[model samples]
Target: MELTDLAPLARSSIGFDRLLKLLEGSRLPEPADDYPPYNIEKTGQDAYRITLAVAGFGPDDLDIILQPNLLAVSGKKADSEARGKGFLYQGMIQRPFRRVFHLADYVQVRGAELKDGMLVIDLAREIPDAMKPRRIEIAGGQARPAQIDTGHGG
Candidate 1:
């Protein structure tokens, strides 16, 4: 869909005004996202884990990609393995898939490992020094912040 096609949907929600403003006028065509199923878990205070079900995809067939605040995991079967004779009914969900995740500020992908057909993606929240609360240095006695009333009555 074109950018204009999504304009009407943004106006339907009152709370979405802030998000719409943040997105500005830039638009990305809707993508036909893949679905093989996944799970996101809060592993620690500042850690998270994303587990994707990739039953037939091995470690070499998967790729973890990070783009600014977006993380994507894509997988494809390793060149159709030569099956032995008498093998039939490929029932496993072995198709290629790509999954995307939107990350918050300071969030970083720490590690990724595949085990038993499950792809685990580790994430950690990196609190920037500027954004973290720091104790203010008091030079003996610090002056209070000033509040200026710039409005003048006529």
Candidate 2:
């Protein structure tokens, strides 16, 4: 969808212009790469996890970078020319890839791990105290009436 499609949302919403920019920027000009599949799931109320199938890739081959508003995951196969010498039917894919994810405000990367050929990344959203909801105390009653004194001769 184009930015024109989001004009209604932009007009109706407030403080979400960055969201529109992110959505517009995420659209790839070329066809999306399907290699190295990944999944994002909500683990808790404010926690999330991203799992990527990275078979034949070691820790040295992958790089995870967390920027202010972007999470980039890149991988480079180690010396494929040396390993790809002879393979009649090579089904395993070990090509280089770079995947990027847009992060919302207050969303942070907690940790990451590679297990069973799966790279799992943990994320959590931590809203600041200033943004959290707060309750206001109400007064029990109204103020008392004030007495006025008039000037009189004693």
Candidate 2: RMSD to truth: 4.6
Local distance difference test values of all predictions, in order? 0.79, 0.87
Q: What is the C-alpha RMSD of each candidate to the true structure, in Å?
A: 8.7, 4.6
Model 2, 1-154: lDDT tens per residue? 4534667788899988888887666674755687789999999999999999999788989999999878999999768664767878778888899988888889999999999999999999999999999998988898888966666734
Alpha carbon lDDT at 25, candidate 1: 40
lDDT of 1 by residue, 30-148 (tens): 46665778899999999999988888787888889998768988888755463543457766766777787878768999989888878888999998889999999968777898978
Error of 1 at 29 (Å): 12
Off by over 4 Å in 2: 1-4, 8-14, 25-30, 80-85, 138-154
